[model samples]
Target: MSQDLFKEINHAVLDLQGAQLQTYERPLKRLVSLLQHPDLETYNAELTEGLDLETFLEESARTGGSMVGSQRLLWPDSAEECLGLTFLLLQKMGEDPAYAATFAHDFYYSGSKIIAGIHSLTGQLIIPFIRDYKSYTQSKGSALVALQDVRSRKVFIVHGHDEGAREMVARFLEKIDFEPVILHEQANQGRTVIEKVEKHGDVGFAVVLLTPDDEGSVKGGNLQTRPRQNVLLELGYFIGRLSRDRVCTLKRGELEIPSDFAGVVWEDMDAAGGWKQSLARELNAAGYSIDWNVVMR
Candidate 1:
């Protein structure tokens, strides 16, 4: 299946050359139209099956066509489909490094304007992929070593009054090459806690410790333990600053989460026995590129 797809992709590359020389606009427009067709989904699925998407994209970028040509290509009518097909082709090219490198070179140099135009029309998509791709390629050989630079990768630790739990989390973060930013430790003399948090807003990610620090009365007049008011505030702040995925909530005990924010996923720190593995997963999902093998060991 991959071989067949590779041949088709090679044919597309050949078509690109012919289209550039002869009737430029028509063939380019037709190719973009064909990519947007629903049938392309099958090809995309077939090509991506059992493939490591990030590695495929990285290899594709490092292989394939010449980096010199500049051709005016037609923008896909559907930006979503165009982006999807682009990713699929990159994955398909991964099966053949020679083809992948050739396609990658052409895509990067010649298709730059086409991608830019797609971004201009769609308003989002492609820029983030490009940034992540660049990061993936740059850290190719020494990912584990790169992760050890705490200064470059900072994780803000939001915790309640549970000193032990917070310390444990901080130590775990440090082991994974993350510089844990504790609010109290880094508080400025004149600034408020909120102000201090804002000061370190550039931190890539945050981990909120939801330890049972405070008791609250429920509708049935039963008292339940919950995180401190400040902890909740900081959690909300991080959620706003760095989306839900980038902010991980680690619950230590039977804590009652707020009704409004009940949908947020919380990992049980006690149940896990060790939080490092789960933390590593969160870091990778949040685009940190953590090599778990080194960190876990």
Candidate 2:
């Protein structure tokens, strides 16, 4: 039963994945039926009952700006939340067509969250949860389902010689509910530099601080400032590990910017405090829900 349901739901979700405006509703309606199924609600609740809604709702709740005010799609209770309010979105389309119509595509296809041309909907987030629920209910994936709703708030920060910049960024991230991972601050335990980064860097997002700590140029040419060598290396590394969209770069000092990489977002680490909102927008664009209130301050 679970296998059949998973297959059906996955197919419907795939149909919704890259669907165009004209073709979205059919698959979406199918999903509504699948989600509202009696067996599904029961099965999903039993398996997902253990995971807390708070962490799971962190990102989803941020999209409330697009939601129909009366709809309030987030139900703390299980079964509904597991689907990322996808079903409720349909309700919004009907109840408040004028408002919901604007962002309806977000409910079906998540093309905007693409990295290297790969699109994801809420962390692929729903599919994995369903898989975990199936596995856990079967008595096989107890550990996986137990931890699935625990959002990874860790963000990796790579910087060079700018303690002020690092501290400020870390504080801002903390304010917005992310644990910033700064390499030198971690316990060495005899591990090398790369080893430390590898160990403490299982983060979903990476913020690179490109502050000028060195200067160089072609052998005969006048030297131009540059970020430390390690900063560039780690920037490239995280872009590879986490994809370009997941990593953000903050430029400071006099260094020339790195070559533009697709999906990688960069912001001027400015002092007028605009960088906070800028960073917030980038993080939200990458699928993390950012609170404008906190960002505005």
Candidate 3:
């Protein structure tokens, strides 16, 4: 099969749903077998191009270093599936004599942190890779910066236009020993998107309401027009520093999860104000809250 054919098959496997499990098992298994063929091993690595698994894994083992970093993608899209596929590939690579020893070595020396973002409204998912080498205690480069930024924070609440959700987040904040700032409520007084991001950027937690109204439109009457564009764009800006788990998405009303974020863990707040209480519970458990001294500390 052509490289493109392999990619297409891999992409399809990533999108498999529970309902399609029976149908997907066979094809995915075959694809896995094809990837390991000696003749086909020449294709550059998909995620880390130009580096074969044996070489990368060996370097990771010998140097106690890794190459995984932050990556963004459309959720429910192929990225989420890719995350799972990678693990499978790792295991397959380990079976090969050339890669097995290094795989074992790297597994012992390097810790993996997989971060992914799920947009509740649009369902766009971004996936990033991270690693820590046990031998090299100091971090160097963008990967090191990403690791350093992983600090604990207080609770934060990001609101789009849902007043009730805002109130719920506020109450949740109080429970978590932090104050919640409602952007929608404050923005109603006339603040631009930039101003909102500037003020809330430092907050401990950011909960964006992914309702239809949050998306921006290029023209009037189109479903994709003017709503969460500013908020999402701002969120995208911080992708380099924060892991996906730091962000949570809540959808309200008849809105459905966007194709991109389909792979993320999302909650439905469509009925009976259940979302407010549930979200508060989850955030508290996640230790999300604001700390005035976060930056100072």
lDDT of each: 0.57, 0.62, 0.40
- At residue 234, what lDDT does model 1 achieve? 90
Candidate No. with top lDDT:
2
TM-score against truth, every candidate: 0.52, 0.60, 0.37
Model 2 TM-score? 0.60
What is the clash count for each candidate, in the order shown?
9, 0, 28
- Ten contiguous residues minimizing lDDT sum, candidate 3: 114-123
Task: List pairs with backbone clashes in candidate 1.
Answer: 63-100, 63-101, 63-102, 64-100, 64-101, 64-102, 64-103, 65-102, 65-103
Per-residue C-alpha lDDT of model 3 across residues 139-202, encoded as one tens digit per residue: 2112222222222244445555666666765665565455666555454346676666565666
lDDT of 1 by residue, 1-297 (tens): 233432343334323322222233343343344443464465445433554545544654454444353322333464333434455553444344345334433443323433222212111222233233223334432212211221136889998889998999898888777889988887587998788989986686799999999998857898989899999999999887766656788889887889878878888897545667777766654445566777767
Off by over 4 Å in 1: 1-152
Provide the lDDT at 20 for model 1: 20
Q: Model 1 scores what on Cα lDDT?
A: 0.57
Native-to-model Cα distance after best TM-score fit, residue 194 in candidate 3, in Å: 2.0
> Best TM-score goes to which candidate?
2
